[model samples]
Target: MNQINNLVRHTRLLEIVGDLIRVRALGVAFGDLAMIENIDGDQSLAKVVNLDRDIVSLQVFAGGKGLSTDAKVIFLGRALDVVYSDNILGRIFRGSGEAIDGGPELPTDPRIPVGGPTVNPVMRVMPSRMIETKVPMIDLFNCLVESQKIPIFSVAGEPFNQLLARIGFQANADVVVFGGMGLIFDDYHFFRTAFENHGVFHRTVMFVNQASDPLVERMLVPDMALAVAEKMAVEGKKRVLVLLTDMTAYADAMKELGVAQELIPAVRGYMGDLYTQLASRYEKACDFKGAGSVTILSVTTMPGDDVTHPVPDNTGYITEGQFYLHNGFIDPFGSLSRLKQHVVGKATREDHSQIMNAMIRFYSGAVEAQKKQAMAFELSPFDEKLLKFGRLFKERFMDIDVSLPVIEALDLCWLTLSECFDPKELLMKQNLIDKYFPKSAHSEAEEGETVAQVA
Candidate 1:
């Protein structure tokens, strides 16, 4: 043991202590740098087990690949402090918030603590305003309300990243905070270029932890993102939207750390407190009683497309509703936003609620009709009409490329309905049809004649 100025550094050989390999006499300072050193070989890493009064525990980043009994341990004097400020916008940082884009170092401002206390419940306001993404399915159908906590439930190989990028570019939010966990380098570059190309980088802040980064660092992303979002929202910036991709990676990091700490596994080798951990991040989305709000949209990928996967299963309980991403598009039948009703008719046009419901009901009939046709059943006249309606509905509304405001999209719905069957077959209220339906019945008649000519 050597004492210099009041700090001591003691080196001890590695030994097993209570299911953990202990490197005795490691120098420790109060919540300072918590890092591990390799012992025998230069390439191996060790895992930190615990930290006490003057002792620091470290877990190796490389899985003890080249470590042996004799190694060196060094402790820096401080806990991890993620740098944040307005300067962070347009800058790309690693999962640990270190600038990685070959840019200048971030100027620190009072070093805000990551994963700080939640916003007070009494300070929260009920969410009301709509957050339009300009995606027809999200905007015209399931409207995303401000301060809502929603997740996109998908599987691997799906285009969730693309969907997220589109929303980041198109959302009407004042600012976007994006956190990506365990992303591949290609996907990382995809988001970077997507934001830059769309010219939204000025208002976007990204925290990325690549698959090659330290798994321990993956745990820091959500906190980093939420901390920045809270700061922006508190400053009266309305509509701060946070997008987190691959929350499943974040959970896996937790499980790995739990296993390293020798904690007994709960479900599927994950910690029993998994739900609490996720809830803490999700609950950060709230409308301040007087200030702006943070709305959260995260992607939770299920393994083998299993909805019962612990990550998605727990997420479903915590979030308000979910958007199911399937086949490179948002599935109309599977995707839903529970708060849509709050804005569908009230915040949107008078005809929105009726047209939305009627269109979906007709679309469902069309799906059933298609199945009957596949079975070679005799087609009823209504069935044929439903099939035609379904085709038009998908082309006009279900396609992701369709972009329109809520009222315009609703009017288009009425036009599509009129193009199909008569107004009475729609079963919509007569007053709505009289007010919003197309005035020229002859238009549909002309379209029928045109189709007849082609047939």
Candidate 2:
């Protein structure tokens, strides 16, 4: 408030609207943290979300069920802040930044406000570097470049969480900030256990809002996680990989809160500002011109697998690209990384782009051959080869369980290609083939000689 503390306390008139409290306090700034003291001497967290002429609308993090008009509202004179430090790694936090892992509080750690400004574009470098997750679906097909904002689009019954956990352990980034919104306790445990077993938790900070947590907290989970990530990337100069799962839940929380606030519904009953709200978070992905970067990989589940649903639809507009996870695999036909060109060939091995394109192309052909076979048509020799290659390709690389370095994955591509057809039939660059083709795909005489030498 602009006035002295006594004047601020004198005008403490307010009214509660569900979870939102309108306090008629003058000169109150947005994002100012506050507390509502109830008659029972219990205080709950609140933050300034809207500022009218002189009335400030505050969203209570803990619902306002027990609050009253006469409750003493105390403004903390600052934005919502989260405790930050290297000590935060391997820790679990609630949406309000309180520890929930039976561990001691981290109040002594340095504090950083949530939802800070993103890195200036002029100060940001082009995301030319890649972060290898060792998952062919990502590393080979849609390379995860530094600071790229992307989402995994999937339907229910898909293994997006498993895929995310795999990436968390496999990515070579210096730090991992995992924000799990509306996750079941089991999923939360799975992420924690996966990171622990893989030895990545020591470099990870997890902020979770379980399905049972307050709806308001669920909305803040992403901001809190990104806040910590920004700290590590800017001050610590670390490559931070932020993994947010099931952002559909995040949007749903917003819808529920908007309904609570009596806001008009827009497209498909979602709040009208859905796109802007999402971009504010996704836009936080940044690659500092000289410092480290923050790359975002999130999951947004589609109801009934409908791409046109409000959440994923708006996300498509904000993020750089998306990984469409469906039918237990990352869909090569649907998945794309717009920034892959900056790294696939330039940063990876010279054959990375060629192998990626070739593999997906063959996979498409294999699908056609399968359709023809299903029609009871006699398969040609080429069709038969396609059938054989398709099975091996899926088994060796496409399956989510199949994890390998970019080099090994590329080598496997050549093996599957050779097993399907002669080198001339591949239609890849002649120079690339001659330079990078595997010896296993060589002539029969050369292969036998190699086998004999091995024997």
Find the candidate with the highest TM-score and give its number: 2
Q: What is candidate 2's local distance difference test score?
A: 0.87
Could you give candidate 1's per-residue lDDT for residues 286-398 as a string of tens digits? 99877899999999999999999899999999999999988777878888888888777777777777777888899999999999999999999999899999899888776
Q: Lowest lDDT 10-mer window, candidate 1?
A: 1-10
Global lDDT of model 1: 0.79
What are the lDDT scores of the predictions, listed in order?
0.79, 0.87
Instruction: Report each candidate's C-alpha RMSD, comma-separated, in the order given.
Output: 4.7, 3.8
Model 2 clash pairs? none
Stretches off by above 4 angstroms in model 1 are: 1-10, 13-32, 35-56, 60-78, 442-455
Candidate 2 lDDT by residue in tens digits, 239-271: 999999889999998888787667899987799
